[model samples]
Target: MKGTAILFQADQSVTFIEDIEHSVYEEIKSQCGCEHCNCKIENKIVDFGTVSPVFWHEDEIDWDYGY
Candidate 1:
């Protein structure tokens, strides 16, 4: 619980993450997501936005994230 965490919501937006224990991050990654989540890992439905699946699929919406 001594690291940073980035929580990706189902709405395709980040939660402006806080001090979340690393276990929580690992837990979320181990589950299969529902309809609201447009993510798939290992041919299974997982939470999207964790890795930003929207731009990955080309949803016709322009996603411009410049660093």
Candidate 2:
């Protein structure tokens, strides 16, 4: 399970959103502790919206092994 996290800046407040499949919304919501699943905009309609791309990688690594 790997994805990206995006942050949006608005006039009043800042919002965080992610670009991923709808099926994974639950997992992302839980992790981000976001009140809503989708991005909230005050006015105007946006096509791609104000989403900054973030790269995420999930892999199993041995932490016990010293660097």
Positional deviation of residue 47's Cα in model 1 after best superposition, in angstroms: 12
TM-scores, all candidates, are: 0.36, 0.20
**Candidate 2 TM-score over all chains jointly:** 0.20
Q: What digit string (tens of lDDT, one per residue) describes model 1 on residues 15-65? A: 422344454445554542534433333456644443322211112222376
All candidates: CA RMSD (Å): 11.8, 11.3
lDDT of the structure predicted as candidate 1: 0.40
Which regions of candidate 2 are displaced past 4 Å?
Answer: 18-67
Model 2: lDDT to the true structure: 0.36
